[model samples]
Target: MARTGALLRQAPLTVALAVVALVVGVVTGSLWSPLAGRPLRADLAFGLPSLEQGRWWTPATGAVLALEPVQYLPILVGLLALGGFAEVRLGTGRYATALVASHLVGVLGTAGLLALARGHGYGYADGLARQTDAGMSAGFLGAAAAATATLRPPWRGRVRVLLAAYPLVSLAHVGALFDVEHTLAVLFGLALGPVLLGRRPHLAWRQLTRRDYRLLASGLFVLAAVEGLVTAVAPGGGPLFATLSVQQKHEELANADTLLGASIQAVLWLWLARSLYKGRRVAWRWAVALVGLAMLAQVAGLVYLAVRHLPGWPAGLYELLGNGIGLAALVVGRRAFRNPSRRRARRTAGSLLSPAHEDQRAAATELLQHEGTVNRLAWMTTWPENRWFTDQRSTGYVAYRVHAGVALGLCDPVAAREADREQLLGAFADTAHAAGLVPCLFTVTAETARHALAHGWHALQVAEEAVIDLPRLEFTGKAWQDVRTALNQAAKLGITFRVGPLSEQPRGLQLQVKAISSEWVEDKGLPEMGFTLGGVDEALDPQVRVGLAVDADSTVHGLTSWMPICAPGGGAPVGWTLDVMRRLPGGFRYSMEFLIASACMAFRGEGATTVSLSGAPLARAAPPGGAAETGGSDVAQEPGPDRNALDAFLDRLGQTLEPYYGFRSLQAFKTKFQPRFEPLYLVFPDEAALPRIGLVLSRAYLPDAGVRDLVTLARSGH
Candidate 1:
């Protein structure tokens, strides 16, 4: 009751219109009976006949009545919905004026058009001219269309699409007098909307992304299916009604063969729609070929009709034009479709293990050995699963993985020279695009993000790298109490810390490490995540160091892996990045704290100046209700805008995964080391690619996750 009261107050004009319509229907005894085929209709219905008879007031009077008893429901519903929306956006005064103006224009303009073509042998137009239609649908539709100018994309795009598609599809499949008036009314509203809203209507097709292209292709496919179904069901109707010779018209075409063909075509188009929307290459090729074939068939039909001097060539021309338009869209949107079928993708996956890829992998390793210390994640680029992108001069290379048509780079490029960093980024983008993949950089430093942003890219903070300057590090302050207690607890428990390559560790110790990691994975609902987060296989790299927390009984309580952070132009390693932390269930509670502190101390003793706890994906620290702070580094970086939708989404995602991965817990655990947070960013060139980028990121992280796993995640809830 309260909600209804609020709505009534908010939309007085809409309420008034609805009230007037209901009262008119009730007073004229048309509420429960047909308003048409009665004297009341002749006095109130608006059309060409009424206009010619000088009944100038009929358009206004008829706008309040429905043609039938059943139509009162739609009239009242439309008045409340579309009318209320327009009234809310435009206010009562402007909305009232727009409603009156649009109704008059819709009635008179459609009548004038029908009048012009009435006696010219246009069968549909002539038939509609003598008809009398009474409804407020045209007025409300126009008002809603005009109000669309006040919306923000993608809502603006969505509403405009519905508004346009309805009238057009209606006119094409079920041409009624109201359909003509509705179409004209909305067209006028769309044109007039911009003028009233103080803006000029212009197309910005360049802003459309691959996702938009896919949606367009999908919509076209559905439209084609609808057209096929309509043509099979109805003949000699609609605005593009097919005219045929007497002999051909009498030859029934709605037989088993025609219905079967239309059904198959519709099924094919629908299947293509689903696949094309996913950006499948095979689906795109099939759509292009099918649409092209349709165009070709239409052209052949037109040629045959012309050569034979048939009377219905115009019908063939309309079909050809539609097919031509569809073919053009498919061709123009070719770049958006790049995802190969699963079988083809599997075949392509073999290239990663090919001899050529091995050489690039070796070069990536070599590049990292010489320049990996530039960023802690530089060592991640050397992982075997990654594909490398080298500049033309082979000066530097970026390590990336392809997922869902995205070439997602792991970190900043490993440059042989500092000057080659930006060049490597540019080359990687070009190479990815050349291969029909969208290029995106993940977990990059502020400097790298800045370089990309300067060239018209966007950046979003995804994580915060926890860096501890070992030279200035200490475990003495009150904040260091957790570390001290953890250390003391480990000593009392007879748990010793061992650090070295896992391959160098004993067979028993390695097996124990595997058991701990495996047990950890078994405890989670989700599969062990990857991408930046390494596993046991990555920790076995002879160059990578592993830290083990073991008891006096030879049992491993917890373990950690450290990737060497090499300085550009190698000497001794300057830092170590912590990765692959795992602990036994029901084991030492302080194992993580003890292991991390010991590693930092061990690295410092070995002349390493810094130690990175590494960034936890989708986890960051920002002061309450404020921007996420990016510590003072060589380059100053600040979080993008506050309440950013993407940032909020990531935060929500982190919370969802918290129960499974404990990423946020791990981040809090890192604070015991007194590490400063450096913001890590995912940078890309276009805003439109963010949705695809998000999906690719999930795929990169959980390559083995299937539909069942996603359903499980959804059901898990917060």
Candidate 2:
């Protein structure tokens, strides 16, 4: 049963069709001989002959003019075997199409060749010659060609060459010259077979080698030698020197030699096919069926031929046996070369989890906490709903998503020893890797920077931290020049400055609130800055501090606010802080500076040693290297009226506010500061896990609607 299944699987179509053709041919051959002997008394032809003459109707043609059944039975069998193998490999549709087209081309070409020969007055037209033949040789060749076309890159060229060579060898039969009719038909069939149906049926070289090529080669070689010797020792002459003068005999010998070469070619093809299909597995049924059917068809053809006195029966049978052996070899070879690792990898890739799955969040969280620190930047302190965490404070790491993969990240570190930093970074990377993630680190620390370079982390963008040093923080030099000029311009307009708490007195309250309200409207735009006294009362808590600036006329000029830097115990505020500041027309520069200075003095009186003047309100300029710094300094010396105006404004604002706010105009206004820029390091568990984190964060806090504006405001210090 298994063997039967295998044979069916291997050559289902070929086996079935071959059996039908053989049965039809035998029956036809049995009945047609008697009719052929009687000859035609009148001019009446039908079937194949009618078709050849372009006539649609002719009943006699069917029985009398179909292929000389007995003579072409072996050819039909060979074709069926070849076509079946080709069909199994190439797929039924493609194989059938190629075979049908090739056969049509071959039949038409043979007809054309016959016409041409007759036109040239070349050979006698016997009764047998008038009949059209039926065989699958052309179709099989077409399938073979199609199969060759399907080979992969490495074997394509060799397969092409083999296909091309088949025709050349077939044409080498000189006996074709004497038997022009049959010769023309065969030659035409060979020529047109591949032309009309160019694609070779798809066959794995491995299977071909195992099932057919190797054994076919051996069989063909033996048959060729036997045929050559028989021709050499024919009855016309001496045992070994027979028929030396006959051109037909010489052609036969040449054909035998060509067949010998074809056998070698078959052997090579088998080897290559075997090599290519070495690691491929085949279904057991398919393997058995294909081999069995081919062998069966060939055997059946041989038996029928032997009964009919047809030549080449033994050779054909041997060829069939060879095909079976080749198939067996392929089956064994495939089993021997399979690779388990590659199969596993394919399975793994196929099963990768989708990003949107909830499991991904769990995976990301587990990956981050595997290490002590989750290194990533805090673009938004609050995380969004769709992300792994609802806030940045959550225990998971944030990762930067890039084209290659996720890059693990951490917010700039507040403080850490060099060793600690290294440990954290390494742990971050290890965690990410454990979770099958990629790692990326963003940093502004020299130590972290060096470590990143050493470890092959890519440097994307370098941003400097522009800061004001509260201890030595004073706006002076070129920085204050712009402020001083603005102050002087305001003084000319009769603008004056004062400083006090929000609830100081009626005048102070009115001026401070007005200034705050006006500045808020101007900066944030009226629609965005909607508020009234009631709204302010609702929003501001007792913990908030307010400062006001007023003109000599008691009109509000500017105002600002701060929240105290609370102690660790959360008792009284430890430091007076300047959080948000704004200014209006009258004494704008002076009042703004005064408010800051007053807040600082208040904080200092309360025993605070240092002030945290916040970062620059804009994206800081790129840092200048050695020679570039010198060039910048040179440019600063050639200041014009604009510089003078800036200087005047800073002078007035700085002097009045310096004592209270500790504000040095030169230090505050200058682009260059002497204070050290502290490093902030963003750490991540690893590089690969960054994408999911980034996607989650980006979606929630920085939704498509508010992302641009938020970024702008943050950069502008609003």
Candidate 3:
């Protein structure tokens, strides 16, 4: 009850408006009856002829009155949602302006058109001249449109889609004047959205993103072309098409010419959209030419209609005016589009981490030293596979790669303090949005996911990263038997373990390790994944050290490259993660076991407390769910057949490669150390970005994967 009181106090204006509407409804419903099926609403309702008869104030008064009690219900609800929303976001004065402006745009704009039509000989114009209508719906829709500016990400997009959809739905069911007027009112509201969002100057003509510009061009082209198509094929014609015929006359040649002209315009618009996205010089010329042609056509059409005293000029002149602003804004934003490079579009991180940016790597090293107990995967950012976005203060940095338009962040930004990490992440998101890319974070910890959520990002648990806390670990229980046996067998075979810099190793041994890696790839018949997996090339990094198991004869049996997870500023290596792990085919049965056991003991001696076995991509989730089939008034028995295909395929692949890669088994084997499990998440700016993110991630991980490769892997789990 107290909460309700507080809410009512907060929404005083909205509550007052609803109360006034209810009082009006009661007064009209009881004191008077309908004269001709419409209560005494004619006086307050707006119509062209009525306004001309000195009832010019109907626009403001009409929203307060309703026909009956039943009619008041929906109008009151609309006020509660739209009016309340606007009042809260835009304040009282601006919200009032949105309502008044949208009401007038609908009332006056429709009136002006009707008067022009009545002056001509159009048959439909006579009825509209006196067809009085009253409601708060126009104001409600306008306020709703304005309220969208205050919504958070993804919701704003959803609201825009719904607002655009209303007009399309009304146009499909064009049985009343209210439908068309409502659409116009909403468009007016959308036009005023910028003002509501605090852009006071030229609110109707604001800068638009590439997506918005392309959509506007596409929408205008469709309207012009489709109107002609409809008129040519149908008899009485649509509201837009029929308005062109003042004398109710139809001409085949006129329709044909309209279609042909609009068709060419559509083609030009699409071309312009494409080129505009690519930042092409010709696209700018095309935009000016197309917009100029449209303006000219509308001007010419309006003059011809006036000369003939006809009602119709351009059917959607209001919308054309809105699009004109977008086109102008596009011209203003010409510098945003960069010319495409000759190279094929693919994921690249080298741009920010090249030898020229050696200072960038040094900064990364400095930042890593901030965390004394860093995870083993911490050093992967210094690898060539990732790019860096550092804070202005140089207090933190984020690692990422760009594939398609998606900026896939390696994880949350790495920093000395949580506060600095947040600031860095906020800046990273801003930069990604500015570049028109979808920002996504891969393998993020729970702490990072929470921070992202606070900034309005969505996170989904993707996988679990296995980590061993070296200080607390003990190989003394039943779970440790397998590891203990591997260690014991290493001494028997004279398989001595060694750890040192890969670059400092014997050249002959390095070549042999390379041969073994090549053999493993050829044996599997699948391409090596690059994003999270490393190869011999990555092993050559100066900071990364190698671990190998070899006999007294210096014959390398197995090798593992461990990436240094060091403290921020090129500090001493504090932790290690398995990056490149391979054993020669049929070379040693327990080679991997021996190498891992020795590496842990070696890292323990160096005062490092953790080792990470990196995440396995596409190995976590089983299947993407499908809509289960309902059994007619009962619950669904089972999901559709192909619903679990992906999950099933991954499981099959895991089994097929289990003998060679042993990723899942490796995770299982690490359990003997009883490591702490950390959940990793995939954080994206919004749900709409998931598909593009998924596609880009696939290309990033498996650049050489093809239809044949997929078929081969599925067939034999290779």
Best by TM-score: 1
Per-residue lDDT over 216-318 for candidate 3, one digit per residue giving the tens place of the 0 to 100 score: 4444444444444443334333355445554544453455345566566556656566555544455556666767776777677667768888755445364
The TM-score of predicted model 1 comes to 0.75
Error of 1 at 163 (Å): 5.5
Model 3: number of backbone collisions: 13
What's model 1's overall lDDT?
0.80
Q: Sort the candidates on TM-score, descending order.
A: 1, 3, 2
Q: Which ten residues in a row have the lowest lDDT in candidate 1?
A: 621-630
Tell me how candidate 2 scores on lDDT.
0.42
How high is the CA lDDT of each candidate model? 0.80, 0.42, 0.66
> What TM-score does model 2 achieve against the real structure?
0.30
